[model samples]
Target: MNIYFVRHGSTEGNETDQFQLPTIELSERGLKQAEVLANRFKSIPIDIIFSSPMMRASQTAQAISLVTGHAVNENPIFEEVNRPTAVRGRCKSEPEVKEIMKIVKSTFTDPDNRHSDEEDYFQIRDRAQKMLEFLSKKEERNILVVTHGEILKMVLALVIFGDKITPELFYEVKRTFVPDNTGITTIQYDLSFELHESGWYVLGWNDHAHFGEF
Candidate 1:
């Protein structure tokens, strides 16, 4: 099975570097980016599409579905990491928000620590595991999923490092591998390697060459 994960396109909050609200919709450039991304999918054989229920991700998935001729399945498991509600729609540059973010980052060393309503390291990690398990059971050979950056990062780290993925390490991976809007990430799973391997291989990550079309 080949899984293609796409980060949702940009929103107004993205342009302003704010902690976006779940209900936020994509910006004009983001919509165009999604269209460009879908155009690239014309050459790939995608059997099914899945998306986080958030508006930005759903809109991005819908754009791809139009090109791929596949209906999108909205799944909450693919939603962005549950961030503290207080930061929603707030600019990251604000001193208070910065302090809150600092506290949040400091808590990364503790898997169960939570500053507020945000998802703990362990919870998000387990959710990533569940997502992989869900994909393994699918009959489709090619699957596409639209999600947010943070959870996408979590998924990649969990797939590549598995049990060795500590909270601290995950933080670094998240920091170093920032995914762009509409960037495509691909992972492959082969049944033959199930016995001796995780059966998952990172074929590609954050491929956004289609952005050149804009």
Candidate 2:
């Protein structure tokens, strides 16, 4: 299986650095980024395109669909990590950002400590895991998944490191794994190698060669 993991383009919340709202569509720049991204994959072999139910991802997916001629498939399972409803559209102060980061950190260590309105870290991890499960179950050779940043990192860490992701590793991903607007990460699972012998291979990591620097 070949997978193209893409982070959705910028949004108003993103431009203002507000906490994720989970329903905002792409920004003007985001739409252009998606177009460039779509052009990048115009000739690649993709059998299907999947997207989070969020509008940001759906619109980005539509940009790709315009090029691939494949319809966007929305799956709630691929939604971004859910924050507390109250914090959804609010600007986070330094302390508030720290608190959110704390919550983000908690997701890596304790999956059961889901906040009042937010999902449990473990639930988010499991949701990321399920996306991979859904991928492996599909027979499509090439697939694209348009999603948010947090879930993409979680799922990519899971794919790169398997079930052995520890807090240290999660932090490493948080620190270094940067998927800019419309950046693409490609991976392939080799069937020739035993499921245990040869596993997934990462062809690219946050590549934006098609559109230069973000």
Candidate 3:
């Protein structure tokens, strides 16, 4: 089984570095980026297309669906990290936003800590686990998932480290890895491998070769 994980295209919030609103859609450039991404999948056979229910991800998935002729399945599991409502639509550079972000970062040391309505580390970890399980149960051999950056990172970490993953390690990975808009990350599962052998292996990460110079 080949699982293709793709980050959604750029949004106004992404371009401006603001805390994204839940209903935010893609920017004009982001729409073009999605079309380029869809073209990249023209040669690759995708049996199923799954996307975050958020508008940005759905837009990206729809672009691919138009090319691939597969209906998109919108699932909440692929949604971006549940940030505090207070910061939604706010600029990241604002003092209030900065302070909130600092608190959020500090809480990463403790998985159970929750500052407000935002999802804690443990919640995201569990969601990542669920996402893997969901994919494993799917009958489709070629699955394409369009999601947001933070959830994509979580899913990758869960796949790479399994039960051994810790909050600190995840924090480090998140800090080091910034998935580009419409970037594709792939992982493959070999049915021949035993449970102990861990059949899943990462084939690629953050691949954006489809967009030449843009």
Candidate 4:
């Protein structure tokens, strides 16, 4: 199975470095990025299209849907990580922002002791695993998933490595593949169900070739 994971385009929250921006919509550049992505895969065969319920992800899926003629299916499990109440407030200073990130990273790494109010990492992993399992059973060769950066990272870690992801590992993966707004990452899954044996390879990451480097 060929799974194409796409991170939603830039949003006002992204520019502001906010975590929980449910109300933030896509920025102007994000719309253009979506169009570029859509045009890039206009002719590609996409069997299924899944997206986060968030507007950013849904809008991105809509753009690709127009090109592929596939409807976007909502999957709440693909939503971004929930932030802790203590860290919900927007930070003004650099040190405050760093503190918030530290808490966020802690929440991501420790599921049991996650923030005062946040979904456990285990829950996110299991939900994403179930979705991938469902996709694997299907005969479709191509699947498209539009979601947030954090969710995409979790899915990739679970599907590609089949192991609990540490913050260090996630950071390493992010550094290796800096997915831009509307960027696409293609991973080839072998017929084998085993993640270690599966010939999981990154076909592309943050590829904006369609946008002409703009």
Candidate 5:
């Protein structure tokens, strides 16, 4: 089974230094980005398309669906990781911003110790595993999912090193491979071995060649 993960297009939140709103739609640049993304997947044998319920991701999925002829389906498993209520709608330079970011980052490598208000790292991993299981069991082997940047990183960490990724290594990998808007990450799962074994490997990461001369 092969899964193509697309980070959602740029949102209004991406363009400004404001607090994240409850629902952010795509910016004009994001719409064009989505068009470019659609063109890249038009020739692929994409059997199904799934996206986070978030407006940005759904809009991007719609653009791809227009060209790929695949219906867009909403799946919560691919939704962005839930953040603490206190973190929302806050300015970027708030003093608590650093602490909030620290808390979110810790969730990537430390599955056991999370603040009460935020989600545990295990929850993110569980969702990623569930999304994988759901897609892998389907008859359609070629799949596309549009999701958020941070959660994609979490999913990749879990898929690559599972729950044992150290905090240091997590930063190293993320610093080197964070996905850009509409960036694509591909994973190939080999059926010959158990999932716990070396059965799956990333075919590519943060691929955005489609955004040429833009």
Candidate 6:
């Protein structure tokens, strides 16, 4: 089976540097990025389409669906990790949803203050593993997933390379596999289940040839 992992188009949060900004919508450039991706995959026969529940990913998936004619399945499990203060840390008072958004934005911008009360790395890994396990059992020949950057890196690295990912490794992966707005990563999966053989094998990463310059 072949699966395509795509990062959503650029959002206001991306322009301003935010982590898991749920309310942030796609920018004009972002919409164009989505269109470009849609055009790129217009010919490929995508069997199933899946996206994070967040608007950014959902919108991207919808745009792709316009061209591919595939129905999108919204999956909350694919949503970006929750970084709300109440969820992550011991807070004196519960932050308002907007306040939580601010905190998440701050966390991404200021890495020095990141992980103060962040979600456990293992939790993130386990959730991603569950998704992979579900997909492995599926009969779909071609699947597409639209999700966040960090989660994609962690999941793809674990599934493809069998590497023990560290913070440093995440940084390296981000640098090496920089997915532009609406960038696509393609991976081939083995039919038979085996340790090294059954997991993902990356065929292409950060493919934005569909989009013209800038």
Top candidate (lDDT): 1
On lDDT, who's better, 3 or 6?
3
lDDT of 2: 0.81
Give the Cα error of residue 147 in candidate 6, in Å. Answer: 0.9
Per-candidate TM-scores read 0.95, 0.88, 0.95, 0.82, 0.85, 0.78
Error of 1 at 65 (Å): 1.0
Per-residue lDDT of 1-214 in model 4, one digit per residue for the tens? 7888888888777777766556567889888888888887876679999888888899999999999898998888777766666554364345865676677566675767654676666666677677667666767789998888766676677654666566566567656655677777787778564546544655666555676846
Error of 2 at 195 (Å): 9.6
lDDT of 5 by residue, 65-104 (tens): 9998889999878888777777765666788976877776
Candidates ranked by lDDT: 1, 3, 2, 5, 6, 4
Question: In terms of lDDT, which candidate is stronger, 1 or 3?
Answer: 1
Evaluated at residue 9, the lDDT of candidate 4 is 82
Tell me which residue pairs clash in candidate 4.
none
Task: Return the candidate ranking by TM-score, descending.
Answer: 1, 3, 2, 5, 4, 6
For residues 1-214, could you state the per-residue lDDT of candidate 6 as single tens digits? 8888899998766775545457668888888888888888877779999999899999999999999889999998787766654543233243554566456545653546654555445666777777788777778999998988877877776765465656556556657766677878887778565556655677888787777745
Model 3 local distance difference test score: 0.90
Give the top-scoring candidate (TM-score). 1
- What's the lDDT for all of these models? 0.92, 0.81, 0.90, 0.73, 0.79, 0.75
Count of residue pairs whose backbone atoms collide, per candidate: 0, 1, 0, 0, 0, 0
Tens digits of per-residue lDDT for model 2 on 1-214? 8899998988878888888776787888888888888888877888999999898899899999999899999999888888777578877765776687577556545556644567655677788888888887888989999988878888878877887876578668978987887888887777575654336667888888877634
- For model 1, residues 75-178, the per-residue Cα lDDT tens digits are 99999998788899999999999988888877755756667878878889999999999999999999999999999999999878888889878978988999
Q: What is the lDDT of residue 63 in candidate 2?
A: 91
Which pairs of residues collide in model 6?
none
- Ranking 2 against 4 by TM-score, winner: 2
